[model samples]
Target: MHFQEESIDCVDFVLRKDEVLTVILGGGKGTRLLPLTEKRSKPAVSFGGKYRLIDIPISNSLNSGFEKIFVLTQFNSYSLNRHVHRTYASNAVHQKSFIEIIAAEQTVSSVRWFEGTADAVRKVLPYIREQRPKYVLILSGDQLYNMDLADFMQNHLIDPETEISLACNAVPEDQVYGLGIVKTGIGDSIKEFIEKPQDLEQVESCRQTSGQFLANMGIYIFNTKTLIEVLEDQSLTDFGKEILPKAIQEKKVKAYVYDGYWEDIGTIRAFYEANLMLTDDIPKFNLYLEKTPFYTRARSLPPTKINNAIVNKALISEGTILNHCEIHRSVVGVRQFIDHGTKIYDSIIMGLNRYGSLDRQSGKIPHGIGKNCEIRNAIVDKDCAIGEGVKLLNLKNVTEFEDEFVRIREGIIVVPRHTTIPDGYEI
Candidate 1:
């Protein structure tokens, strides 16, 4: 089917916020993003230095005037719950809007945890039914993208017969192996769906005339009745692997082509690359967007303090204190303290959670990077204490190695959160 570009007049189509409920899937184990997900849930993992992974989708929903959101989390959800509560709790009082965290719980009928994406929503059907929303918007928590969900919802409403509208992007053939590919017959009508096509012929068949495959962005808008109907079959576990393919055959599923910067931060390499990409002069994902601002917890802290630091192409978040350090092409997160003579390049330093009192009296290593350290092409997770003269360069270029204090994945060193590397340590 030939697709044409047309202007969408959003002024005529007003979306009632109360009629749509946003459900963010945050229960995935995030095994691919391990070590980072060892302590926190996938959504709670830090992203772009300042914001958590969940903040991207939640902020997008809020900016699009969809305020009633439910974040479903299961594996290691304490931090995720706390963040959502603290950051979005005030919305309930001031704006009459709320972003609630729905952790998995054992019920009379189900004693197990969330098995997959569809299963997670299926278990929450009772709570979803109570909301009485005309449409339900499902989003992934671990992706980095800014979308006007109101626009997406408007497109879904354009076709009354579109029971489920999937937001898709045209990706190259090489990128189709990890994403769900769709085949369209007519304008925006999805005829066939395949999850992670591995066979060469299967992947080639799904490619469009433009020589690009329609890759699912894991963003879906479903009629409330249709969602409930699809989840009625308990056999279906995952959305991409099971639910979407069956729904395309039996239900009216459409495609909403999105031409924007979207990156699925599923692996450590992807996460590292995505963070570093933000340091570019013209990044694909713009965190500095004015209208659709990225929202997170409001920490009333002092501004970032740089004292004679030579920094270039770096994203230094709020409340960071840099002293005579040379940083280039890196992302320094919130409340970071880099001592004098330290040099960081092509790295991501996830800063400390708080300031002050780091075992000074006990002679223990304090939080933040110590003096004279050289870190390159690495990821320093939150609240790590690297003693003076420590080098995390991974000079040998080992692909995979792990120890008590550090881990090297895909040739990038990862110093896990709350870890302490003693003085004169080298890799």
Candidate 2:
């Protein structure tokens, strides 16, 4: 227990930051994103060339001024643990503020692993209860969005009847089937949480005149007592699938309509598209917001070195060396080495630990992309070694693939960490 009772007491005294105890779920085995989640948790996976997925919610909480937080992690949580511990230490002014990691542990009372989102919280309710939280702000680790939670909390405070407040997004009609659609009745209270309502008529009924249906963002704010009551039923494992729908039936749940950019980068294809979206002329989810900046571990390395590189509409991270490569609409992460004559477009090159030329010469192990390669519509993970003249075009236009070092999911080839496509290999 890194959080002391004294520190919790300090927050309790303060009128701000104590009302809500933000609980961010560090996702389950991200099977959709296979090899990437092979060694690290989903939250620990790299995003936007610099920040990790967990950074999004943590930054949102800190930005919202919620100091007392806990991240529930399962499955290969080492990297996520290290990141939260180092990046989110106590603030200078508020020495009591902290971000703690609570990995699912087996105890005598319960030996079962986290069955789902609700179950994860149910197992750790004891610790959360100790903090004496008025409300519990449930967040997803892999969601890319920005919202001032103060607004959500304030809405709950003002509306005393609403026991649960759901952050709902106005999504396009096309995506209404993919999300948990909400139908709010009179008094702005959500009447039902429709799980993937298939019929067009059902979707039309949920629309809000903006030609977009009100979709549940999977962001939940629960009154501490109500959440505990709901979780007391051991059968309820997931929120969207079980708890929220049940709550809508029995309790007063309100829809906090949010009109903003939100992307769930859980699957490989979604992750690929979201990263490339960052390279757009004007990304829908802008990271350069001066007022509220996303927080991450500060790796203060050297500046990116571009030597005779033809770059356009790209996001190049720090400490990368692009030598005579033609890159367009791509994201290059930290400490990468792109050799001369490589043409990369609409791709994500998650950078390496160090230069790879020496290792390749010694026949030990290759690291970065070698000379004269052409890659397009792909995601190359960290420490990947692309040999000289290698072509990762997915020439066959594969929608799904699994090979020795490459994986194609939904037409996007993903090379996980430490993967080495040998010299002259063509895909």
Off by over 4 Å in 2: 1-14, 91-93, 198-204, 355-359
Task: List clashing residue pairs in candidate 1.
Answer: none
lDDT digits (tens) for residues 1-427 of candidate 2: 1222232234433554656798999999998887789999999999999889999998888777777889999899999999998888766666557788999899999999899999999999999988998999999999999897777777777778889999988888888777899888886799877888877687677777767788888898999999999998999999988998898889989988887899877788888889988888789888998656898888868999999999999999999999999999999999888888999999999887666464565875467888999999998999887889999999999798888979888899889888878888888
Clashing pairs in 2: none
- lDDT for residue 128 in candidate 1, whole number 0-100: 91
**lDDT of the candidates, in the order given:** 0.88, 0.86
Give the range where candidate 1 is weakest over 10 consecutive residues by summed lDDT. 1-10
Q: After superposition, how far is residue 111 of candidate 1 from its true place, in Å?
A: 1.4
Using lDDT as the measure, the top candidate is 1
Predicted model with the maximum TM-score: 1
Model 2 alpha-carbon miss at residue 142, Å: 0.4
